[model samples]
Target: MMLIVTGYMYVEPSSITEFVEDLQKLAITARQRDGNLSYDAAMDDPHAGRLLIAERWRDQAALTAHLHSSDTVAFVGRWGDAMRGEILKYDARRERGLMDE
Candidate 1:
């Protein structure tokens, strides 16, 4: 099963640029991981300092590897104070898509 990880983050206005840069690095590292399926980040259009991250992994093990990686620790360190909310995870199964048709 794919693991879906979503995060709703609020960054300090001053750290927004740095936070984004950090996310880009993390994304690069995630893509190189064996279990990574997809990792995307986007900012909220209407809300300043608000951002969202969505990730899909091949399985729990892959996601676990990502969470335990040094990149993840560094990413967290860079954004720890800027983070406002919780990171959420869910087990996902694709229910409908072009392939399903």
Candidate 2:
């Protein structure tokens, strides 16, 4: 089953700009990974310093691998406490486009 992961994190307001920039780069790289179906990192509330992320993976193993990938680890480590946040995962059994018939 596909896996969907979503979450939000609070970062130092001053760092929000750079964080989002770097996150977008990471998302682009992740999408090219073996099992990454999609990846997104965006600012949900700039004033509140809330950053949002939504990722889709082929399975648990793929997700785990991505989590441990060097690039991912480096990105998260760079932000450290400033971006620490909660993430939740779910099994995505199926999906469809809004206009799909």
> How many clashes (backbone atoms < 3 Å, residues ≥3 apart in a chain or on different chains) does model 1 have?
0
Off by over 4 Å in 1: 45-47, 98-101
**lDDT tens readout by residue for model 1, 1-101:** 88888987788777777878888888988898998989998887324678887888999989888888988987777667667755799988764676766
Per-model TM-score, in order, reads: 0.84, 0.88
For TM-score, the strongest prediction is 2
lDDT of 2 by residue, 1-101 (tens): 99999999888888889988888888888999899988987778999889788899999999999889999999988988677788899997878898987
Model 1, position 63, has a per-residue lDDT of: 88
lDDT of each: 0.82, 0.87
Best by lDDT: 2
**Least lDDT summed over 10 consecutive residues: which range in candidate 2?**
79-88
